[model samples]
Target: MDGSISTSISSSRSSPLRFSHNPPTPRPLLSPTPRLTPASAGRQPSARLRAISPSPSPSPTTPQQRQQEPMEAFGFDALKETFSVDVAAAEARPLNVPLAAPFTIASSRLEAVSNVAVRVELSSGAVGWGEAPVLPSVTAEDQPAALAAVARACELLVAARSAPLGAVLQDVADALPGHAFASARAGVEMAVIDAVANSIRIPLWRLFGGASNTVTTDITIPIVTPNEAAQLAAKYRGQGFQTLKLKVGKNLNSDIEVLKAIRLVHPDCSFILDANEGYTANQAIEVLDRLNEMGVTPVLFEQPVHRDDWEGLREVSIAAMEKYRVAVAADESCRGLLDAQKIIHGNLAHVINIKLAKLGVLGGLEVIDAARKAGIALMIGGMVETRIAMGFAGHLAAGLGCFSFIDLDTPLLLSEDPVYGGYEGILRENPAHLQFPFVNVLLYSYILQL
Candidate 1:
C-alpha cells in the first residue's frame, strides 16, 4: 500500500461505486446508502491498527532526529472538488424523550436533538457520507448558532479558502463571544475529522491509530421502573450486548428494584450506573450502600451529582469507597483533560467517561492520555448520532485500548441516518456501503471547486 500522503484532492479511480437513497425518491432525505462493488473491495486492514503499532517508537531523541523520522502520510489526492449537489433541507427532529425522573440532572427539562450531515464524493463519481449529532440539552442556545456558523465555515473550507482545523477552531472561538457553544463546536470538529478520514480512504478508527477493528461496547437501557429495566436488560443480552449501563437516581428504592430485576435476568453481564448528575451526596451514599447490601456491585457510578457539585462528588466517592467498596466515575464533571486532572488530583473519582462530542476530537485524545497517566479507568461514549458519527466513536474506542467500557449505541438507536456504507451500513439487510472511490470523488470535487 502507498504510504505517501496525497495533499491534492483530485485523482484517478480504478472502479465505480453506486449509492441511492433507501426508500426511493420521496423519502430520500433519510440517509443515503452506498453500494460497493467487487472492483472497489480492497482487503486492507484499517489505518488505526497501523498507527498503534508503528515499527519504531519515538524515543527521547534530539529534535533533529524526531523531525527526520518519516511521518505517516495521509493520501488525499482522490478527494478534490467532489461535493456539488446541494443538500436538501430537512425538518429538524425533536429529541425530547423524558428519562423516568428523579434521573434528570443539569437541567429541569430536556428538549431538541440536532444533527449535521456532510457528504463526500470520490474519484469514481461515487459518494460517501458522514454525520454528527448535536444535543440541545447540553449546548443550550449555542446549538443552532454553532450549526449555522459551521455550515458557513464548511462552505469556505471545501473551497480551500478556510484555515487549518486548529486555526478554524480559533476563528470560530473568536467569532463566538462565549464558552456556551463548546457542544456545537464539538459537532463541527467531529465532522471535519470524519471528512478527513473518509477523503483518505480509511476508517475513522484507523485515522486515530487504533490497534483493533472490533471493540466491546456497553448497551445502555434507560432508567425505568424495575420490571421495565430488567426486561430491557434481557433484550440487550439476547442481542449479544454483554455489558449494560443502567440510568439511576429516580429514587433509591426504585433504582435498587431495577438493579435487582436486571441482576436476576442477566446474572453474568457487567453493570454500570449513570446518575446523570442526579444524586445528592447523602442520597448517592445511601444508594451505594443499599446496592452493596444486595451484592449488586457496579463497575462504576457516573456523575452521581450536579456538574458543579465537586464537593458533593468528593463526599460521595469517599463514602462509596470506605463503606460500599464502589468506585465513582466522573462524566459531566470531567468534561475534558483539565477537569479529569482536577478530579485525579483531588482523588475525586476512580474513573471518567470520555465522550468525543463533549470534548472534540483532539481534546478527547488529550483526556484519554491524561486519564491513562492518572491511573483512572476510561469509558468511550457518544450521543445519539448516525452510523457516520458512531463510526468515529468506534475508531476512538478501539484506539484508546484503556477504556474499560464503550457506549456507542447511537447509530443503533437512530431510526434513520443521512449517509451509508460503513460498519453498521454493511450489517443492515439493505447494504449501503460507501466505497473508497466515491469518497475520493467528492473530496476531489470539493477541493477543486468543481
Candidate 2:
C-alpha cells in the first residue's frame, strides 16, 4: 500500500465514532448495540460543525446595482455618473452665406450657400450648432425643404426631453430617413451630439478618437476657363496647397485644357480629378488616355460615372489603377450603407467619399466602420457649407485619422463665414496645418456608441 489512510471528522449532527482501515473477518460473538443517553440526546453540535455548513442565501440585488456592474467594468461609470443628455430646446432656421466666387462643379454652380442652421440646447444650458448644407444637384432637398425637415426634426428632439444618446439619434433618423431628409437628420444629430460632448466637457475630436489633433485638407478648383484655372492654381500654390482637386467632366476637351493650364503653372503639385458623375465609361477612359499621353497621371479620379452605373464605375476604377496607377473614388455612387457595401464587395471603386449631408452622422459612422473592416479607403468631402458643417467634418476626419483624401475646404470658398469657433480661420493662417481649439483630457471609445 503506497498510500496511507487519512481521517477527517464529519460536521454532520451525529455522535463521534471510530474510523478503522480494516477489521477482522470472524467476530462471531455479538455485542449489544450502543444506546444514547438523555444528556447526549439534548446536546448540540460543536462550533466546528457549524463552520462547514451551508450559508444562507444573500439579499436580492436591485436592478440599478446589477446594471452598474457592467458600466463599472467598461469604465463608463464615471461618465454616466457625471454626464447625461437632457434636451431642453431645439431650433432650426435658414442659413445663407455668400461665396467668394461662383463655385462651379461639373453638375452644378453655386454663387452662395443656401443652407439651414440648427441649434440644440441642453437642459444644463450647453448649446451646440450644426448646418444642413443644400446643393440642389446633389442632395434630395432644396433649401426650403431642408429647413422644413430640420424644423420638424428639431421639434421631435425637444420633445424627447432626456434620453439615451443612441435612442435620440435613432429617433431623429427614423423621423428623417434616407437621402430625402439626410441633410436635416445630419444637422440635428450633429447639434445633439455636440451638446452631449459639451456637457461631458470633451472635444469632438477626442470623443471620436485621439488619433491626431489636426488633418491636412485639399482645396477644390472649380470648372473654369484654362486661363482662370491656371490663375487659381497659382494662387493656391502660393498659399502652400500641395494637392489640387479639379472639378471636371463638364466638357472633356475643356477638362484636358484646364489640366494642361494648371500643370504649366504648378507642375510639382499632385492632382485629383473629380468628374462628378459626368462621363461615360469610354469618355472617362479617353480622358485618362489623353492625360497619359501628356505624361500626367492623377492621384485620384472621383465619381467618373453616374451613381447608378455600377459596371461603369468598376470599369473606370479597374482601368485607372491597372493602366495609369490612378484610383477612382465613388462619391455619388456611395450614398448609404447599402451603396458602401456594394462598392466594398463588388470592388466597384477604390475609395468611398463620405459627406455627412448625404449620409447622416450615424450613417456616416456606420459606413466608416464597415469600410475600415473591409480594408477600403475613405475620403471626407462636403457641399458648399459654412464653417458649421465643414468644421464638424474636419473634426471627424482628424479624430478618425483614417481618411486618405480630405476635401473639407468648402468653407474657404465662402465669401463670409457665418459660424465661428471652427477650423475656418486656422486653415487660412496655415493651409497645411489645422488645429482645433478644444482641449482633450479624457480619451475613450464610448462616444462611438452614440
Best prediction by lDDT: 2
| Candidate 2 colliding pairs, count | 0
266, model 2: CA deviation in Å? 0.6
TM-score of 2: 0.79
**Candidate 1, after superposition: displacement of residue 209 in Å?**
1.8
lDDT of 2 by residue, 1-450 (tens): 122211111112222111111211211111121111001000111122111111111112343653453221211223334455688898887887778789888889889778888888889877788788899788999998998999998888877767767777778999999988988888898887777766655666556753444566777899999999999898877666778889998999999999999999989788888999999999999999999999988877899999999999989888877787777789998889999999988988877899999999989988988888887777889988865687688777766677777777776676554442343122222234444444321111111101
Q: Following a full C-alpha superposition, what root-mean-square deviation does model 1 have from the true structure?
A: 11.1
Best by TM-score: 2
TM-score of each: 0.68, 0.79
Residue 165, candidate 1: how far off, in angstroms?
5.2
